[model samples]
Target: MNIHSVAPKRPDLDRLLIDSALALFAERTYEGTQMPAVAQHAGVGVGSIYRYFPSKEALGNAAFRYAKRTLLDTLAEALADGGPAGTAREEFARFWRGFTRYASAHPDAFVFLEHQQHDTFLDPESRALADELHRVAADFIERGQHAGAIRDGDAEQLVGLALGAFTGLVKLARPAGGLDALPAEDLDRAEAAVWDLLHRKADR
Candidate 1:
């Protein structure tokens, strides 16, 4: 039998590699991380990494895309629950809580994504996904504006402001230890601040 033909695809191994890569990348950064380190972290041979990903760059992009998709999927689910129709503040609050929960629970994935946002290793597909995420966020902001709950302004600009605030809060909440170590009250304050920034003056 041809060895190549008989080689089994190990999705478990692939997941392990990606998870390990995310943790290492978050701790050491993309350029500072190596395939050997990832393999060692995953308790696999260095050559095994190439079976799932051709190169370090490929692994980085794959990890980023995976994390981004996971985050987006979580947000989608948070928005899917039947809530008060057209109640933008309630919907936004639910989504924000879900986002922070995910970010805190999966700090490695969140950190990896945050650090790789501008990485050149990201392929066209990854770049497109990033754009899609932004579009989704802008749409959410536009919905609030349409409902007269958000301040009147450019949707994208509003998104940028909200995103900046959330990102800063995430960073501040994240101590040298991790996001899970952040105080619950501090996280609550961060969410309130973001909500206040997005709320219309008339609604306040």
Candidate 2:
């Protein structure tokens, strides 16, 4: 069998290149990253990358899609577990836990995804996937507004605030070791603080 022909969305070699590329993208950035460097990082030859990714932009989009898809999957799984009866607060907690889970599992990917700008080199599919996740987040906020659990505001702005605060919290933990190294008490308090930013004043 020609493994490459019938392989999954990304074959093993393809995944390796994508991972190496993402690590570089996180460290050196998209424009700074080179195909040869990616190969060296992955312990492969420069030609191997070309066989899988036609160019740096193609490799970048692959990495972005992989990272974004992983995040979307993590969040989706978290919310799916919550089911139809889950309260807005419960759903919100799921999102927090989901994000932390993604960051913990794929620190490089998390950094790669968050640090890059969408308009830079993301292909249509990559941007569409990001937009899909954003819509999911906005839906959560709109639902919370109806439930009177979230504070009134533009859902996009609220999503931005929630994500910005969450991102800052994670960044604060990186230098120390990772989110796991942070005290449970501190992580708990950070989650609560973010919730406070989104919660309705009347929620009490």
Which candidate ranks first by TM-score, i.e. highest?
2
Question: For candidate 1, lDDT tens digit of each residue in 1-204?
Answer: 656666676469998999999999889988889899999999999999998899988898889888889989888887776755458787887778767867887888887776454456879998999889899889888988888899899998988888778777677767755556777787777778898989898733
What TM-score does prediction 2 earn?
A: 0.91
lDDT of 2 by residue, 125-173 (tens): 9889989989999999999999988989999999999999988877888
Residue 55 lDDT (model 1): 94
Model 2 Cα displacement at 107 (Å)? 0.7
Q: By lDDT, who's the top model here?
A: 2
Which ten contiguous residues of candidate 1 have the minimum total lDDT?
A: 111-120
